[model samples]
Target: MGHWLDRNIVEPGKLPLLLALAAFVLTFLVTRVITRLIRAGRGPFGNIRPGGLHVHHVVPGIVLMVIGGFGSVAVRGHGPGAVVAAVLFGCGAGLVLDEFALVLHLDDVYWTEQGRKSVEIVVLTAALVGLVLAGFAPFGVNELTPDELQSRSIVVTNTLINFLVALFALAKGKPRIALIGAVVPLVALVGAVRLARPGSPWARRFYRHRPRARRKARVRAYRHDARWAAVRNRLHDLVAGAPDR
Candidate 1:
């Protein structure tokens, strides 16, 4: 176990990444708790307004992200500098993503149903980053042996194949599958072969001419969504507070 950690994480200089992931997730959770308190009118927190203009958290988030990103690039990947940059970036990301729906809709919808999107996205981002910190590599290339990695042709071929499979999964309207496929190609292949989302580009182009298949796909989607909607909503509320309406 020690050797595995040493080879996969320490040697690859991924400690900063793990730290960033932790900070990102923790920041998001803390931010949500504060916001939830504010929404309930129970906290010392209040809305920030200057000159009758509301100041959103995303502004500071953007600044931090820029500084951290540029600073990291300017400094070496290892050591204290990298760690600091990663922490800053993660903090900024949590702030920005917590208000993602506000940016997307160009409105103050923090307690509305639209705000749930921010929670969903934040959860997804945290999950993906957590996976990375667990030693999964992007594009399934980490599975290559030293000999295969040393061969330019083999590495290139493997990467191209994984990229294509991921793309195919995306084209099928399976974003979650495609994302996982970037780390595990087998998942992508399965997603690519499955039925496309009824509203996806793939279904619009391919299922348009196949009525029975489209109907079945639609039914399946509806059932799945119905089954998970309650659980999803509870999770969103638990993390970001219940919607205003």
Candidate 2:
């Protein structure tokens, strides 16, 4: 175990990244627990307010992010300073993302259905970062041969192709797939070739002239949502607590 840790983490200079990921996840979970407890009125914790203005946690999060981001840039090597900076940045990111919906909508929507977006974004962010920690390079660069990696044109071409595919997936309303596809091109290819979701930009523009395509897209979207929406919601509730009715 120690050998694997040294080879995969320490030797590769990934200790800070690992520490950051751990800090991010732990901060998010702890924040959620505290927030949930406050919501249920079962804890000593309560919302922060000053001068009749509700102070959101994201404020402190932003400050921490700025400090840590600069500190990480200023500090060299994977030393104590780097590790501390990484942890601070991770914690700040967790706090900011926890209130992503509020930032996105410019309103307090933390306990509303719209707030689920925050949870989803946080989960996606964690997954993407975790994939990076697991050595999955963006645009599938890790899959290329040493010779291919050495060729700038070849690397650029490969990245361009994968990026376009991921962009296509995003246009098809498969943001999650597109994001994952950035690291795994095959997933983006699948999403790109699949029918666009109903009401998505791609579907609205391209399927408008094709009645059959529109119908099929709607049907597929409905079926897909019916199949997975409950499971997704349950997972969200389990992680972030149910939103206000």
Candidate 3:
């Protein structure tokens, strides 16, 4: 059994098929157990809420976890397998930490309306998987070349932008809007990155203009806040003086 576990995991040799199968099965089992605990609703041994499910948060996380777990099964001492293993290990670590946080979040003392929406564990896991897959893809398959790390970087970056959009949408309770925002910004960001590459004509122009816009926005924000502070003070004084009237 000991050798089997290590063979199924920690050593990815002559077992690509087995590793893949185990990765998927293990991922599913782990996720179901975690989800059940999350649903059991409170103590170290309880769920986050009474029979409640964090579907959006938990499902994507489950998918990522499976991908990573199987990847772990195939990780050997070096090369692509090693990289995949490291990524899987990181995912495992994140899942453990997140589960701990979920316990805290479920506690009545720490639970807040905003806290209810935030599942840092799920977000971070998704992000990690995105990064790992991007990095692994460019190096793993024969169809891809080694020099495509830049493409991986772009993939990671775009995944982040999508995550942000999803987070914002979830917070606002507008899943459709969030989906649109997630898709649009990601497409735009990727397009921009591609256009900014060495041979593109817009690359130099985009870089030259991006910073200036940011500076202008920051200056505008400062001025706006200054004026708002003055108005706020006046309103405070008026409210304070109302009793005398």
Candidate 4:
């Protein structure tokens, strides 16, 4: 175990990344527990308010992010400083993403249905980071041969193609696939070739005049959502606690 750790993580200079991911996941889980307790009025935890203004945790999160970001830059990814900065930044990210809905809507929607966005974003962020940790490079860079990597034009072209495919997936309202596709080009390709979700930008723009296409898109979207939405919601609720009715 120790050999594998040192060989794969420490020697590769991925210790800080591993630490950061651990810190981020732990902070998010802890924060969710406390918030859930407060919501249920069963804990000492409560909202922070000063001078009649309710203070959100994201404020402190932003401060921590600034400090850690600068600290990481200053340390230049070496020594103990990098580890500390990584942990701090991870903690801050957890807090900020926990309130992502608030930032997105510019309102406190923590317990509302809209707040589910926060959980989704956090999960997506974690998954992407995990993919990185698992050695998936963005834009399929990891797939390049040594000779191909030496060719700047080839690398750029490959990245551009992958990026465009991922963008198409996003336009089709397949954000999860697009995000994963950023790391794995095959995923992006699949999503890009699939039909756009109903009301998605791609559907609205291209399917507008195509009555058959619009109907097909709507039916496909409804079937997809009906098949997976409940499972997704249950997972979200299990992780972040159910939103208020």
Candidate 5:
């Protein structure tokens, strides 16, 4: 850990929250700049107003940056590595947002084989995984010491990189790209599971919340089905009563 991530430099508890805020601000600024550049490149003097499609593409990126910024705060306790984690998380968030925005804007031009769909799919998967890890960070590994930085960084970085690579494959029309991209997070998630196992803090929180989540989902499904059942029955009856030649 150098100057940017010195645990000794910042108090453990207060720093994470602050760092999370910083991550958010960083993400916001970076995205705004990127959007501006793209817009400028497409027009003269950048004077032309952006259309709904342009705004649509940028909105998700902005939103994810904001989310990851908060997530950075959550993981601030992980020490120096937290900053690295924050940057990576922010990029992943932005990338995912960019994809969904692009998808909505996709039409004949975007749907074409050479239109970079793979990139969007890869980025979206990475963002989703990053979001998951952001929550898990508090329960995952503690800060990486300077000596351990290289190894741990590799694991985290490779996981993220592989996710992006999978998306690239998807753009090329590869069938298993999404699945492969998903595997990076799955592996890390398993590791997180191991770390949080049984007596660990992460495990305790995860298990405690898991059942509540399931119950809520079940309740929602029951309500939705019950509400729609009568409508479905009416349609069936109407169809059944129709005269046939």
Candidate 6:
């Protein structure tokens, strides 16, 4: 285990990334537990208010994130400084994402149905970062051969192709596919060739003139949503506690 860590993570200068991911996930779990307990009125945990102003944890999270970001940039990546910076950044990210709905709506929406977005975003972020730590490079760059890496033209061409495919997937309202495709070109190719969602912009522009295509898209979208909504809700509830009512 130690050999694996040193060889794969620490030696490749990815210790900070692993640390940040661990801290981020842990912080989120801890924060959720406390918040859930507070909501149940079964713990000593309570909201913070100072000078009649409710102080959200996201404030300190932002401060820590800035400090960690700048500190990492300023310090050498050789030693514990990187780890400290990673921890701070992770903690900050956790706190801020815990209330992501608030940031998006510019109001407190925690415990509401809208708050489910926070869990979803956090899960997405964690999964992406975990993929990176597992040796998946962004935009499938890691798939390039050593010789290909030396050819700027080849690199640029590959990147542009992959980006376009991923864009197409996104336009088709396949966000999950697009996200994964950003790391795996094959995923993008598959998504690019698939049908668009019914209400997606792509369907509006291209399928509007084709009733058969529009109907197919709509049916597919409905079936997909019906199949996944319950699972998605349960996952959100498990991660961030179910929405109140």
Order of quality (lDDT): 2, 4, 6, 1, 5, 3
lDDT of each: 0.86, 0.93, 0.43, 0.93, 0.45, 0.89
Q: Please give the lDDT score for candidate 6.
A: 0.89
Clashing pairs in 4: none
Task: Please name the candidate that would achieve the greatest lDDT relative to the true structure.
Answer: 2
lDDT of 3 by residue, 1-245 (tens): 88974664456442433333334335534544554455456436543443585233333455555766666566544457745654554444444433434455654311333232223333433443443333322212222345654487755665665666455444433343344334445433333332223222333444456776445545654675688756754553332211112
How much lDDT does candidate 3 score? 0.43
Question: Per-residue CA lDDT of candidate 1, range 118-167, in tens?
Answer: 88788778877877777667877788998898999998899999999889
Residue-by-residue lDDT tens digits, candidate 6, 1-245: 99999999988999999999998999889999999998889878998888889888889889989988888887866588989999999999999998898899998899999988888878888988998999988787899999999999998998998999999999999888898889877998898898998788899899988999998888988898999999999888887888989
Which ranges of candidate 3 are over 4 A from the true structure?
1-88, 97-121, 135-245
Candidate 4 ranges with C-alpha deviation above 4 Å: none
Per-model C-alpha RMSD: 1.9, 0.9, 16.6, 0.9, 16.9, 1.1
83-104: candidate 4 lDDT, tens digit per residue: 9999999999999999999999
- Candidate 5 lDDT over 1-245, as tens digits, reads 66644544364343544444445445534544554455447533342245733334344555555665665667654757566556555554544443443555554222233324433444344454444434333212233345665686755765565555544434333333345335444443333322222323433454466876545545654675689756754552332221111
Q: How many pairs of residues collide in model 2?
A: 0
TM-score of 4: 0.98
lDDT of 4: 0.93
TM-score per candidate, in order?
0.92, 0.98, 0.26, 0.98, 0.25, 0.96
Tens digits of per-residue lDDT for model 2, 6-39: 9998999999888888988899999999999999
lDDT of 3 at 35: 46
Runs in model 2 deviating more than 4 A are none
TM-score (C-alpha, index-matched) for candidate 3:
0.26
Clashes of each: 1, 0, 6, 0, 4, 0
